[model samples]
Target: MAGEGFRSALEQADDRIVAGRAMDGDVAAFAVLVRRYTPMMRAYTQRMLNASADVDDIVQETFVTAWQRFSELDDPGKVKSWLMRIVSRKAVDRIRALRPVLDVDDIEQEAPAHSAPARVVEARAGIEALGAALQELPAAQRECWVLREMGGYSYEEIAEELEISVSTARGLLARARKFMIVRMEAWR
Candidate 1:
């Protein structure tokens, strides 16, 4: 009974949003929308991004983009999902833009030395192997795995972010994990 009531309330709210009263010019309605979704966006962005400094910037961009495109939004009930997609794309773009340009000399200098302590060498090798394996993954698979495992997003949330179906997201994550586990075991 309680679940039915909650579902009815949600349906009514979504109806109001779809009717355009919320997007037409009601600041309070928009505020309610933002308040409902922004925390999830922030958490998703932070998980995908290595740098904390840029999380706020990416989140702000996501919300601003959503607000500007609100009228274009096809389904008001999917607002949370749409906002998550925006944040995911923005985070990936920021990461690509900030990818470091590595010098060949620096790379060569970091190569493991035979004389290094066994544990130290092993740890470095593990990190390097993991990095290589991650680089081998398709971008979409990698992002899904990282968001689901590292960011702790639900399958529904990941599907929304990647603009894929929940089943597809599940398949991608399962494949990604299987590959990583196999590669890590081989490394060991």
Candidate 2:
């Protein structure tokens, strides 16, 4: 019975209904989209970005952009990937925009302090150290690492999202893994 209801909801929600409603200026339809995907987008952004207050702003911008261009979307079934692509682009743009003004030494010194129980604190410190080390990597490598490890995107998905070839994504992940292993070893 539950499965039937879920199927019925999905059947009723065919992209055409959502798109038509949105095109007719029904803001509620778009709001529904935001409500459905915001949590996943937030999780993905948090993993890719440094935890900062600006994350919510970035996410809001992503959805706003998505709404503006929603009509251009070729297939409604691809909405999740489309939204994710927007978020990834926004994240990359944010990183690039920061690069000109950011000092590498300052970033290293400003890494977040770990606050948790003894064991958890140690683990968090190690993770923060890893994140700091990752910040030193090439953007492509860092993105591949975060998508695979943090966002749980597969190689093909990461490649599609990053506009790289699958083999390239694999190579980048391999390099990122090797770099992380070396850095974590040194931290021990």
Best candidate (score: lDDT) = 2
TM-score of 1: 0.45
Model 1: residues with Cα > 4 Å off, grouped in runs: 1-20, 102-188
Against the reference, the lDDT scores of all candidates come to: 0.80, 0.82
On residues 1-188, what C-alpha lDDT tens digit does candidate 1 reach at each position?
A: 99678544544476346335556766556666666677877888888986578999998888788778888878776777777888899999998888988887676464356556886888888889988998999998899988998899999999999899999999999999999998789675
In candidate 1, list every pair of residues with a backbone clash: none
What lDDT is obtained when candidate 2 is compared to the true structure?
Answer: 0.82
**Candidate 2 colliding pairs:** none
Give the TM-scores of the predictions, in the order they appear.
Answer: 0.45, 0.45
User: Which stretch of 10 consecutive residues in model 2 shows the poorest summed lDDT?
Assistant: 107-116
- Superposed model 2: Cα runs more than 4 Å off: 1-16, 101-188
Query: Lowest-lDDT window of 10 residues in candidate 1?
Result: 10-19
